[model samples]
Target: MVGVKANTAAKFRLYPTADQAERLVSWSHTCRAVWNIALAQRVWAYGSAQRKTLQAGEQCSELTLARKEHVWLRDLPAQCAQQVLRQLDAAYENFWNPEHPARSPQYKRKSHQQGVTFPGQAVQIRKVSRRMAHVRLPKLGWVRFRLSRPIEGTVRNATIKRDGLGWHVAFGVHRPEPVDRHVNAGPAAGVDVGIACSVFVSTENEGRQRPDTLTAGEKQRLRGLERRMARQLTFAKKHNGGKYSKRLRRTIAQIAVLKARQARRRADWNHKLTDDLAKSHGIVAVEDLKVSNMLRSAKGTVAQPGTNVKQKAGLNRSIADQGWFEIRRQLGYKTRRYGGELVAVAPHGTSQTCARCGTRDSENRQGCGRLFACVHCGHTEHADRNAAINILDRALSTAGRAGCAASGRGTAQSTRSPHGQGSLAGSRMREPSSNVTAA
Candidate 1:
């Protein structure tokens, strides 16, 4: 592997005093205001008769004069406010890039949670005990936080944000990539992600489901809260001029709490699963899925009405809950960190192609059943497992014989490196021995 810089973040729970918390919230609001004002200025400049364009440098110069004139702008940290302008610059850059998917920058709503970022030089960290630490910010001095883990690299910057849970701080750190780790000699595995089973492994011959993060009662309560919120929103739109009442705000907070819990659980599971896979496998192959495309709205135009809209909606929800994109994201960095390789193969017809016989027929996957019976070759296997094997074979074939040898699965037949290597003569499929353990 080539030498490269490794950048990561260390996040910790912040414990701020009541006054400090209030101040932090005010700073967030100031940041949001700066962003909105700068965006508005850019829009106006673009629409002017001269068609003048405003960049961050010119806007920042204007901000400097405004800060001297306005006490409110002067109260916020100058660096923090500058960071907001930089972020706005980035947003515009992304929007202008043809390859970037971001849309034009928009005004920030009061409900949106915008945070403040300070340069590393302005922030200082001091460890007071084994479990607690203190960080000094521009305005907030020596705020305490839980020392969940040791900071492993030089701090590049720190961001302070408020979520449904509470205020938190994240430090961006930079470190040199490790150069002395042992070469990966573990077996290679292919993974299939699906709605029914969160993941299936070709080498392990098993499928695993994500354990329910929320209890049945909690889920029921969440549904009730959602329905109530909908009713409240309708009433507010009709009678209250579309303004959210205090009760509506409280309900929104409650929903945020539940959703945050679910997100944390899913993130935790993904981290553990990816860590294990990275450490155990020399090569990990998964389908390169375009989740956004898969989750596209099923509601067609009135003139061209779609079929099975309800069924597609349910499927979309299931796929989203599985967090396939998150899993792939974690695998990408974890593999690099663990001295392993991550391969993403095209997903076309993986489920329909038989891993054993190389047959491509829709009938191979019959009627949503778990079993996959190849119509042409009379081979049978778990549908997900079959797809996983195909994914691995595609990866191995693409990587050529070098990858096959590294995985310790190298054989004369496997070295041929055909497109469907899983169906190569002498290739054997392992039988399912046990269920995959949940993370």
Candidate 2:
């Protein structure tokens, strides 16, 4: 028996008519209500051992009874509403599983419940033209969307999600990744992600640097807009019933626009960069950086306030703008599809560790310096570039181990997918890992 590979997703912008948009919004509200109601029911059930383990099917039956009493519940699509209960059940399972570090189920706020999933079998997509397509929902009928890319594989499921800009549809499909052994067939290289430059790539011949996502002018505008939005928020809170002023609303919209633009630019850059790397490298290595942990707020409680909170906040913003995690993720899938392999190496001492010599010392590097002057080996190199070199060596070593393991020799195996999504089953990715236990 042959096992099927996992499906990947592609997102596209949706353009619904005014009437369709209003209907979609109403559906979302109903879905949110259902999620909140189901969550409350579960929370209340925990009080009595008799009903503590209420199943999703039981809640779904209850929903059907409620719909009979209130036909308004039946106004929306049945399957979409039922998916809320399914999601709630999954949430509970995740919370209870010790291995899965997922948060317990919480009530969904209207602001956050902005997406709905539709089973692919229940919907149909038709390509209208080269740059146009239409998808049909249960009640919403046919909705138009910009077809930026062709739908290549069989669609498994589709989700409609509203972002800062507008609505988008993401389709999950199992498309075979085209492999080319000739692309990036050269020796493995290393990539270092940092603040000064988003990516510093080192090859056998030379190293290259990719600049930060935002320009100087854009950074200044972002700071100014953020400051303005803060002021607006404060002013809005002073009004009756905390009603936001027009200025506040306008400021928020403006901020959203800027953020959307930033997101687009960053996505574009990452896609191009990853594609190039996958097309060119036989093997690549990158640092396993915990972007979320690294960007955590430094400000603590009033009793024990954190030091350099403001400085840390700024650094967090800069690091987030780089989208290190996204790069790693894109690289994961791209490298695998493009006939290359990607491995992650620990980033602990890559910068300070002399690339030329096996030396690891904190004092080998100095403050706010890009030039790495190793004290022990008397080696000089760009800090990020040197780090890339070290990463490449580690990646090569990992690949060699995997190769040996395949031949029944090495003790360890590498299991990480080039797509960076961890396991096809969707597991949390950790760093300082050699990806032992190859798939």
Candidate 3:
């Protein structure tokens, strides 16, 4: 089968020597400074009488001159500093685009995570042993890294980032072969994501909950650490002129470590879940949820204070914990990789509408219960499962209209369909009621 080229990234843990690590940190700071300086220049240019917009090429020319004048900037790799300018330019371009969701570029703070990118020509990788590799970078040669997996294709670029855990390097590679050459021939499923249940599949008639990333003991320790950090912040503000003490900095690092652990665990679980869904189903359907809008704060203006502030806060936390957007993002690429299709449908009244009867009434859902009893047809089923079924039905109808087929390679793949008034009119599927309370 003829294959298409695809771009992917591979990440590994880096083990730098003490001096190299210090230099890496200093270079990150330099990059951050470059970003801030470029942003300030752009702002000044825009506000000036000429209102001239600075381009990356113009900034690079200026950066070359500045490097000649300053020894510190000269020590930093020229490519790395130029990359920062390019990133700032891209940020501004995204902000200017009406369809893009990115906000305007902002000044980088000292606390922000640090990273630097090197073009393909500036980085050279060499395999040292079965489990070790070495990458030669500009100004910093022969940094050893754990080869968790073999690099699959030609390296296009590499980015090094520092987090609470440690320094890591990610290589962007271009593969000659496509992720999936043949279309998938498998079953279809609709997934309904919720706070109580992480995923509910329409075909399975069951809901699955994600395991907690942090254990009970870890949660307690995290809470205690947060409280201690708050106390330290109070002391620093009142007595130390808002300067962080060594102990306070240590506490912050500890907190970052725990948070990173949780994030890694969550990402692992999401990857597993998405992989399974993509491999088993030729067509997977899900609600097109705007997670940012769902997570908006409910603290209204002082003139009209919001009600149930604490309840809203808790709901926001639950929504964020589920990582709804992350799931959608992973499913998007994974489905394509597995020769499957991912469909997103409007989620207007999936919960209230009956999957069997097409009845839409708010009274069908009584309180915050798992059971969904349809008033029109007297059909009762799990709320999430019913919603999932509705989502699948809508996706199928949308695909049918778009001339999609069961083989998964179709025009409807990754398409979003608006909710139709009569879309759920005849979606009648029967399943055993024994698992109505599975969640």
Candidate 4:
């Protein structure tokens, strides 16, 4: 049956007491230990069977590790222990499959994760009359869930994770809704993505720019973390016994936290931007940018040795914080839900080329210019707005152009530049020894 699938997230605001936090951490540790034990048992079974294959099969099923055998193992819940075995089996199966040759099976370790989910076990949800959850874990008696929204479908599994800021529980549910249709308004809209102004919309809200100040702050924090990490690394190198300083370890953990914060901020903005676009516009047009390639080019360009780095670092940070991929992902689903469609147009020359006359020449455009003074048609506009206009025009010219992967082709795609902003002509860049694909 044709159906729609959506993940309805319900985040609960909870202030778990220190005691509750400790209990949760202990449970997490127990889960990790159980998983490692199960993995070890699987390895032993494979060896006893005189087979080099790591895939969990009949041999692994025959080898059962009891809780009483190990004190740490006994601390884990029964369902958690079972899930560990299942995960080991699944991991082994994946490693054995030749089609996925990149991933190989490896020994489980503590740092892998401390969470477990059992598909077979029935997930219990207890809402007490006065208390939040009637029955909690052995130590955490009654945890509260300030559930902002209702959960739909049959929740198949639940996972508790220690996020950077706090603890969170994610529920996986099975939902079957009607298929969402993709509809577009009579008019088309264009978007310009950049570091200065994260997003510049050119339609309902003309000339409106969404700046990423939060992203900038996160990067500033990241720069501080990097300095601390570097100093710690230096200290470790000088230390004997092949030992690392405790401060170094703590710095790494801090860096991880900063990364998580940055990720959260990016995710938040992407959701907001996608929601706005889906609700306001029928068709959304955006430039196709190769951010991964761009970042690779900027790695060795950082000049400074410490917190005081090159200016390009800020640009690099901004690009990452923009969360273009996350925006695309959210838009892909949200557009269908609200009867809208997203289109990616060729980014080449969209910024430099005149949207009014369709004339493209880099020579006429000065170094890193933001004004489009077209010699052929005398068209002038803000650089981003001009690009946006061309994006909208490109969307209108080609049907199904917004979501087509091949939209990266065409005369709008660029060379040398990441965003394809400096194409000399309305022609694809000539590769001396490579074929130019569609934009």
lDDT of 2 by residue, 146-235 (tens): 889877765655678876699988875555544433344455668888877567888633444455456888788888989998877777
Q: What's the TM-score of each model vs. the native? A: 0.85, 0.82, 0.89, 0.65
Please identify which of the two predictions, 2 or 4, would achieve the higher TM-score against the true structure: 2
Task: Give the 10-residue window scoring lowest on summed lDDT in candidate 2.
Answer: 429-438
The lDDT for every candidate, in the order shown, is 0.77, 0.72, 0.81, 0.57
Global Cα RMSD, each model? 10.7, 7.4, 10.7, 12.7
State in Å the error of residue 36, model 4.
9.1
Model 3 has an lDDT value of 0.81
Candidate 4 structure quality by residue, lDDT tens digits, 1-439? 1122113433344446788777667777776765565566666766785755444333334334556576665665655555555556655655665432225446556555445443312344554433243213333455555454555554444556675667766555444545544344434568787755566677634454555434667778889889988877777777644366777777777877776676676677777887887677766777766666555433453473344345567766667767665565566556555665666767888877787778888754666666667888777777777778888888767745454332322232222222211111111111112111111
The candidate with the higher TM-score, 1 or 3, is 3
lDDT of 1 at 294: 90
lDDT of 3 by residue, 157-180 (tens): 678888889999987665554655
How does candidate 4 fare on TM-score? 0.65
Worst 10 residues of 4 by lDDT: 420-429
